[model samples]
Each structure stands twice: as C-alpha cells, then as structure tokens.
Target: MNNSFSPRTGSPQAGSQQVGSQQVGRLYGVGVGPGDPELMTVKAIRTIAACPVVAYFCKRGTKGHARRIASDAITAEHEELPMVYPVTVELPPDHPDYGRQIEAFFDESAERIAVHLAAGRSVAALNEGDPFFYGSFMHLFLRLASRFPTEVIPGVTSMVSSASLLPRPLMLRDDVLSVIPGTLDEESLVRTLRHTDAAVVMKLGQNLPKVRRAIAAAGLADRAWYVERASMAEQRVLPFAEAPDTAPYFSQIVIPGEGKRG
Candidate 1:
C-alpha cells in the first residue's frame, strides 16, 4: 500500500515526506446530528472542516443524510469518500447471507479508510447521530481506532430531537425510560413495553405494523406518539393510533412517562 499522501487534490498524490518516523493520520468519528444541519455540534463542524478527507456511508445512488447534513463543511478541496453499502434491509438480519455480506462490507470499508490513515491523511467519518449509539461509525471505529489517533464528537440523537418536539417530557422524575428497537419480535416488543414506564421505539420502517400491534397489545397505543423525520423539514407528529400502515426509517414512536411530581 502507498503510504505517501498529499493534503488535497482529490486523491492521494505524490508526497514522500512523513510527519515523523512513523506518523499516521488522525481519525475522527463525527456525529452530524439527527436531521437538521443546525443540530450539529460546533466541534463536529470544526472537525469536518479541518479534516483532509471526509468519509460517510451511503446507500446506492444516494448522497447520504450525514453527508448532506455536513455539506457546508465539505469543500471542493477535501477528498470525499462515499462508502456505499452492499445491502441494506433487503435480507432478513438473521439470514446467514446477510451477516456474511454486511461483515465483508464493513471489512472493505475499514480497509478503504485505513488507506487514508496509512497515507497520513486525517479522515473524518460522518455519523448521523452519536457515533456510539446505533451509528454505523462504530464499526469503523472498532477496526481503525487502535491503529490511529481517534476522537469522537457527540451529536444530538433522534430520540432527543423527537422528545424536544413533544408536548411533554419523554421521562419525568423517577421514570425509567427504555430505548427499544421496533425490529423486535411482537411478543418481545409487547413484553418490553409492558415493563417500561416510558420508551422510544426506533428503526420503525417496515416494522411499523408490527410495532403498532405490540403497542396496542401492551395497552399504550393511546399514549404513544408517532414522530416522522423529527426536526426535519418533512417532520410529522401524530398519535400512534392515527399513524399510517407505513413509516420511514427515520420515524419512531415515543411513549412519554407519566410519573407525578410536586
């Protein structure tokens, strides 16, 4: 692999000089925020501006939400790496092929980013929410962190964004809040909902119907709120029962806690 790299020029050009005897580029896992570009943290913006190479994950034929959110910071002078996924929600998560394909994709992605780090070019991987909280950046961080100087800048999460748009607090004093994924089996979802004082169900795309059934089964459908694209231009807030049969990947259901306080 070529260890020589230049600061800019689209790709790694001719540059033999290293910063030190064995200098590697720094890695930054930057969370751009839930949906609104304004939600991005100041540090995230600064870091994206400073990085020579800006990396982000995207589906085929898409600019990606994270990349779009940080478009202002990414200038023509920066090298942009768009890591496209081999598959996304096409196959069941439990399928053996799904795991194999996704694992290979992550492996290839890590190597691609590793090339930049090896060439002494600082690369910032853009994440939509907190890097460690169900963010794709965690996969890259796991593979490249020990190999380079790394920093993770947190951003506001979708849960927080949805909560802010709600009429009541997501959780009140002494209220236990559970963050559950709508992908859970119906029985599991119902059981979890029955036990938690409050909850936020994420990943509600094709699972919306199943999640709705679970909410009803748990007897919380009346209190549940369905929020779509929270804090974005297309945001929609409605009661869970009124929600349509479908929901986007960006949508979620919020069940606020009712703990009383003086």
Candidate 2:
C-alpha cells in the first residue's frame, strides 16, 4: 500500500462542472486504534491531519469515543461530524426494525458526507480498531464506495493490543488463536472454544456472564484474563475469576495458558 501523504483531488461526478476552483473530495476510513493516541499509526495520523472534515460514530446521547481518540491529531479548523446511532433495546428485525433503522442512518450519514465530498473536501471517518474489523465505519464504506473514491487505513486492533499487555503469548508453536464474538450461542461457543488453543472473546458487555460460563464449562476459564478498555487510561486487566459481570462491550478475554509456543 502507498503510505505517502499527498493531497487527493477529484470532481464530484462525471460531467459535473467544478464550482469555482474547488476540487472534488474523497472519503477515508481512518482507524484511530484502541484509545491511546500513541498507538495510532503514523499513516492514520497524517490522514486525519490532512482531511478537511473528520466524521465519527457515536451513541445518540453519548460523546464520540472515536473522535476523542483522534482529537490531538486533528486541527481545530477541521470539520467534525458526529454520526449518532440510537442505543435501544430494539432487537434486530423486530418492531422498530433495528437493522432498517441503522441502515437508514448510514444512508443518511453518507448523504451528508457526500455534500462535503462534492465540495472537493476530503473527509476522514475515524474508527476505533481496524476499519474492516467489526467497526461501524464499514457501513459507510459499503454505502459510499460504489459512489465515490474511498480508502481505508487500518489501525491496531484491541485484541492484539490486549494480548501484548499480557506476560504470556496469545498463541504458541502450532496453536490456533480464534477471535470469537461473545454474542455467539452456547453451543457455538463450546465448539469454537474446544478447538482453538487460544481465543480472544470480544463484545463482552451484556454477554460476558454467558461467555464466562461457557469458558468455564469448556474448562478454559482458568486460563483466561479479561482486559477492559485496553490501552486506555482506565484500562483494567484481571483474571476471569475476578472480571465483573457488568464489564463494558470493549472488554475482551484472552486465554494464554492454552497456547504456549516456547
């Protein structure tokens, strides 16, 4: 990948005459890494610094975490757009149609972003982890990639960072490391955990207790260490026995004992 920082210019659409002398704009999905600014890659920082507008996902009534992660790297003059996603108990494909609602929100957000792109302004949508790894910014990319020139800058993932915080290796020798979403059903969890020597269970908010039970039942709980908000100022790392039932969604459990290369 070309990591050089160069100004990108393009017209809004084919046959669309340029208004005044402004150039066309591009959309960038820049991963800000897990919480710590120092963890952000040099390429990500340069992209944010150069983009004319910065967009980030946030809960409807809460502050934007991604934006905060990239604040120091961005100049005050850069435009900030907080794209809000409603946080509710509505289940997917249910009454309020969670999927529909979120899809609509992404579409609308893309339209708003298109306005900036049309003006030839480069916009960078900040993501917490690798843009393509379960990050909300991927929704925007799906919606706008066909219509505009889009680029993704990958960032350090929390799972890897969390593993690094440990005293032991996540995977060893020929051991496999499975990264599973804690939302999986009990049976699925058992099957996956039984096969992998090491595993990183993410999205451990409301489903933490369930995951904890699954790991324990699978005889892997003792090997796991839970890390919440890894790399952040308020980071917490504890054994599975001590992890709280109400850990945040950002929490992850790393099982190191199962895999030792040395």
> TM-score for all predictions?
0.89, 0.86
Clashing pairs in 2: 10-24, 24-120, 25-120, 172-261
Q: What is the lDDT of residue 111 in candidate 1?
A: 94
Which candidate ranks first by lDDT, i.e. highest?
A: 1
lDDT of residue 43 for candidate 2: 86
TM-score of 2: 0.86
Model 1 C-alpha RMSD to native: 6.4
How far residue 203's Cα lies from its native spot in candidate 2, in Å, is 0.7
Counting clashing residue pairs in each candidate, in order, gives: 0, 4
Deviation (Å) of 185 in candidate 1: 1.2
Over the stretch 1-262, how does candidate 2's per-residue lDDT look in tens digits? 4644332232222222343465567788888898898999988888887787889888767658888888898787888888888635546544667877877888899999989888778789899988998988888888877666677888999988898888898877878888999889988998899988889998887888899889988899778999999999899999889999877867899997445454
Q: Write the per-residue lDDT of candidate 1 for residues 60-85, one digit (tens) a residue.
A: 99989999999988899899999998
Error of 1 at 100 (Å): 1.3
Positional deviation of 166 in candidate 2, in angstroms?
Answer: 1.1
